[model samples]
Target: MRISLICIGKTDESYLNMGIEKYVNRLKHYVNFTLTIIPDIKNTKNLTQEQQKSKEAEQLLKQINATDTVVLLDERGSIFKSIDFAKYLDKKMISSTQHLVFIIGGPYGFDNSMYDRAQSKLSLSSMTFSHQMIRLFFIEQLYRAYTILRGEPYHHE
Candidate 1:
């Protein structure tokens, strides 16, 4: 199965971008991974939070396919330990039909449509994180998950 991370907006922080790229490169060894960045909504100065979300939702939907299993990184989602995440990754790899898309929404979060499309929701932690930071953090966790699954020494108990 192929895995993709579709995050809204570009990460402006240099450090975060570098970190994300590092993991994206490392992940290639384990699975077919792709990173797609959706442009931020235009003319946001005149729109309400809901309106912005609607616009963002349109872009998010376009990135998806009928066969794709979308997972959103949401605060209310299931929280898993690293080992459990490795098992979850193994499960997805075993059962996924085609592609597994993981989404990181914009600062204001996702619209109703996105929530409806997702097959599941996963939470990294109870604490909140910036969208830019989440890209790096999630990518690292993904890399760690793969290493754990491979029984590599990168992850420690």
Candidate 2:
């Protein structure tokens, strides 16, 4: 199955970009993986939080196909152990999932419409993380999941 990570806005920090790139490259060895960055909304200073999220949702939804299984990276979503995440991915692949799209929303989070479009929600951790930092964290966890699936030494119990 082809896996994609669609997130709003560019990761500004060079270090975070570097880390994200590292895992992204590693991921290419295991699956068809793509990172699509939606441009941030301009002049957010004037828009209300809900308005900003609505605009971001429009951009995000445009990237998704009708056949794609969308998963939102939400704080209130289901949490999983690293090994369990690997198993979950394995099931998707085995079930012939065409495209699995995971989305990271904007700073204020996703709009109601985005939630409606998603098939599931996944939480990386209970603690809040900056959107920029979550990019690196999520990518690294994805890489670790693959390694665990392959029984590689990259992940430790």
Candidate 3:
């Protein structure tokens, strides 16, 4: 299966970018992974939080296809342990999911429309994290999941 991470805005920190790139390179050995960054909304000072999220939703919706199984990275979503997450992904692949899309919404979070379009939601932690930082964290978790699946030494119980 092809796995894609679609996030809003650019990751500006060099350290984060380097980390993300490192995993992105490593992921190639396990799966077809792609990272798509949607540009941040302009002149956000003029718009309400809901308005900005709506606009961001429009762009995010464009990146997804009807056949893709869309999962949102939401605060209220289900939490999984590393092994469980690997099993979850294994099920998706076994089920023959062609494209599995995981989305990280804008600063203000996702709009109602975006939420409605998603098949499921996943939360990395109960603690909050910056959207940029979450990109690296999520990518690393994804790498860890793959390693666990392969019985590699990268992950520990």
RMSD of each: 0.8, 0.6, 0.5
What are the lDDT figures for the candidates, one per model?
0.91, 0.95, 0.97
* Ranking, lDDT, top scorer first: 3, 2, 1
Per-candidate TM vs. native? 0.97, 0.98, 0.99
lDDT tens digits, residues 1-157, model 1? 8989999999998988889989999999998999999998889999999999999999999999999999999998999999999899898878755898899998898899999999999999999999989888889999999999989999998
- Candidate 1 or 2, higher TM-score? 2
lDDT of 3 by residue, 1-157 (tens): 9999999999999999999999999999999999999999999999999999999999999999999999999999999999999999999999999999999999989999998999999999999999999999999999999999999999987
User: Which residue ranges in model 1 land beyond 4 Å of their true spot?
Assistant: none
**Quick one: best lDDT, which candidate?**
3
Window of ten residues with lowest summed lDDT in model 3: 148-157
Error of 1 at 94 (Å): 1.6
Residue 137, candidate 2: alpha-carbon lDDT: 90
Taking the tens digit of each residue's C-alpha lDDT, what string does model 2 give over 28-77? 99989999999999999999999999999999999999999999999999
